[model samples]
Target: MAGGMRNLDPVIAVDGCAVGGEFQGKARPEGKTWLEGKRWEAGALRFCANLSRCSGGRRLSSATNALAATSRNFRQATRLLGLDSKLEKSLLIPFREIKVECTIPKDDGTLASFVGFRVQHDNSRGPMKGGIRYHPEVDPDEVNALAQLMTWKTAVAAVPYGGAKGGIGCSPAPDMGTNSQTMAWILDEYSKFHGHSPAVVTGKPIDLGGSLGRDAATGRGVMYATEALLAEHGKSISGSTFVIQGFGNVGSWAAQLIHEKVAR
Candidate 1:
């Protein structure tokens, strides 16, 4: 079979003799015997040769499948180890939803209509805790999901709080200078149903009986947590640098506290 392969078709011979179905054509010098019978099949020879020269000549399909399977396996393992199916299922319970529509007089002597919603989900632990974002896209489903997350978050933190979220579907952008007034109006409307319970929703202005330091509470909490983490390794936040992404209330407060207490 020494010269028997000499006259055989190069494609078939290469496929038959090559290990792992890979054929290396460039190792041979130009005009060599192996190149003599090599015929191009619509550039198939070049494609296979280029692939063989690659670090690993494995097909993209096999590599992709392998990566996907690995990721799936890792996710499964994490879920099995980290998640409690029964607890998660129990947490997913029916929630109470409130929807309101009202008209507020704008600065231009025009009345603008606004829609608002509040979702109270899972008060098993204590008072609910979540933010009341003011956005035009606010809806019942989004509020409910946020409330549910707050429930989980407060529980995980072992805080004495349940989960509730509320929002008004109005653009609080600068274009709506009347938005601040609308907020007060919405707060009043919500209080009619919730019975003037400022505890029901946080982040209210000080005039609305919001806690004196409540505005900065979240940021201070983050600073405390970061300090705790650093202290765990016998380190302090004296020279540690942090990059904050958001400039909202929480982010601003965190940055302020870090700069004053930790970074300084």
Candidate 2:
């Protein structure tokens, strides 16, 4: 319809009807407008917009729209810093977006395909650093948002690394059929182009060139952060009572460190 409308003369308003910019139950032509006296377009765009608004049952989660929030925060920071608009825009754009099809053979000798995405948000500071998450819900938008966050976080911490995030649409638990093997596959897959780059990704198993403190880094960070905050108030971890929710890898390590401090 759009192609046919192009190269045609301006569509005359039938019966001088004002263009109805909505669709009730079905789509129908309402009125038309001419673009540059050549292309004639109707109110279909508005109709589709309204239809989408009406059909949407629930609002999208802020997590799903993480990039939008990141942009807003970045814009506000840049505005307060009085940065140049051109530079601000340039910094906001991601350095690269990569999507690949990961096809792996299941135990049953059948091939299963999953979509993988990697977003490298920046490289001004140094090499990009991020994690490769394996979850069925992993998506490009979330990965992009995470990559941007890594860039900002590394810059704030004065770390000589940019930001990147990659993930595959697969489970993380071994019982559910995915685990460390997933990262190994991803590392091997990524190395195909980058050529044996271990630093290209973090959070790998110890056998895969992963650093010694990688697993405990987050918990250690929390410990130091808590210590700093307590020191500001002339208190220490041993003098405080803590309630840690969800004793996962990070939480468990943090609890152990704090307990040891109290024992000493």
Candidate 3:
């Protein structure tokens, strides 16, 4: 098996081991066969079982993994900063966790319900700011991770707002019975607690006081960031060519801004 694997592509051998553990079954070097006689299905099952065990005996969800990674990074960062242990613990914890059931009347005169979550991770620097994503995979753990990310990101960028994230386990598609209406619902419910505050949320419809530039804020920020870096090196945005991904909110705006700079 060892001799046969040596003949196989190194990448494939490494991938096989990563997925099925180290090869134990012998292979025929004459045929250049690797793991040919091994019960791959059984090995894969055993690998999954071990993976579950490592993740607290439950199937690892994306949200759980995301939160774990964020927490790990936060710990490492705090250690390097020589932060106070108590403060570090406090910073790692969320300020609030809100879960609500949103029931809306369907077009057919029936009621449909969905679960929503809002996790305010921290407010040490300023008011919390984040987006409310509407997706079926939205969960508390993922929202918490995003919120924590916002906290750190704002601080790093010197933004006056803190970090937060909210979402509902509902489709964002209109055909799926949810759309901007979902965001409106979230805003109303949140305002019931925080009062009528447009600043409390973003990515809202312009009619609801969402800035016309809201969708472009992220892209504009990226452009400005690039400009700053280039300026420090005695370069400028007008002299640069950029490759941006996605035609969506941030990417589109960044491209527009960069194009304008280049054209000028």
Candidate 4:
């Protein structure tokens, strides 16, 4: 023998790789590989072992590493492309942030307080345009991020629109009948500052002077795009199986259009 076998604890090896601290009595040797007998830190090996367990041993470790590498590559690419720090800082600024508190009477005849936020990110091109989402998670940071995205999206689309996003943080699921009332309250509150400029925001109810076709514009656009693509491929919208994922205005309209085509 080259050297006497040092009496030490048996290590726990997973997939021919030593995972962590040694396995003691009652631990049997499973198998062996050339990679064995290599020293590894207990913490690092434990982390790797936990990752393997979490991933169900389906080689997700490689995917995790790939994502890390991809992030590094993205950083390098940004540097290579000469990303403008000044432009990034300027774009990060929010044009305005509005916070309001309102009192609404509950079913119990008690007044409840609600806080709402509206963040206008930019208005370089024209009037600001965006949606007013109603969710409990609505916050200034989220509104700001979405408004910034809208600004960039409008710029990319070459639309004569700036960006604005607003919302009232409240639960919309509790009372379906009260949704319109809530929206009305939100509209009223918003109008105090923005005025009754229907064009400033889309998706307002018809009574609020919102554009007639604006509600289904996105769905109509999607349908048109799909029809053009199918026509190019010698296919028609009729007699086609359609699956819609969302139940929102756009998805609902798209489904209705497709269903009518299929019915005919």
Cα RMSD to the true fold for all candidates:
21.8, 19.1, 14.5, 18.9
TM-score computed on alpha carbons, candidate 3: 0.61
- Which candidate order results from sorting by TM-score in descending order? 2, 3, 4, 1
Q: Comparing 1 and 2 by lDDT, which wins?
A: 2
Clashing pairs in 1: none
Q: Could you give candidate 2's per-residue lDDT for residues 1-264 as a string of tens digits? A: 000000101111111221222211222365333322322232111111122232311224535475786688789999999999999999888999999997889999999999988888899999887766566877788778778878898999999988877767876553432234545665787789879866545556779876677556765766776666556545566755664543555556667876778822
Candidate 4's displacement at residue 233, Å, is 11
TM-score of 1: 0.54
- Model 4's alpha-carbon lDDT is 0.52
Lowest lDDT block of 10, candidate 1: 1-10
Q: Across residues 192-247, which tens digit of lDDT does each residue of candidate 3 receive?
A: 99898665545567788655665566567766766665565456767554444334
lDDT value, candidate 2, whole model: 0.59
Error of 2 at 171 (Å): 2.3
Model 2: weakest 10-residue lDDT segment is 1-10
lDDT of 4 by residue, 187-231 (tens): 677679978644443445678755568556755665665565556
Q: Model 3, 237: alpha-carbon shift in Å? A: 4.9
Could you give candidate 1's per-residue lDDT for residues 1-264 as a string of tens digits? 000000000111221122212243333344232332453222111112133233323233433342244334435654887867675556565357789999989999999999987777877897665656567766676667666666767877899988877777866655422222334555677689877755443445668754568657756776776666556545566776554544455556777988886564
TM-score: which candidate is best?
Answer: 2
Q: Which pairs of residues have clashing backbones in candidate 2?
A: none
Inter-residue clash pairs, candidate 4: 10-23
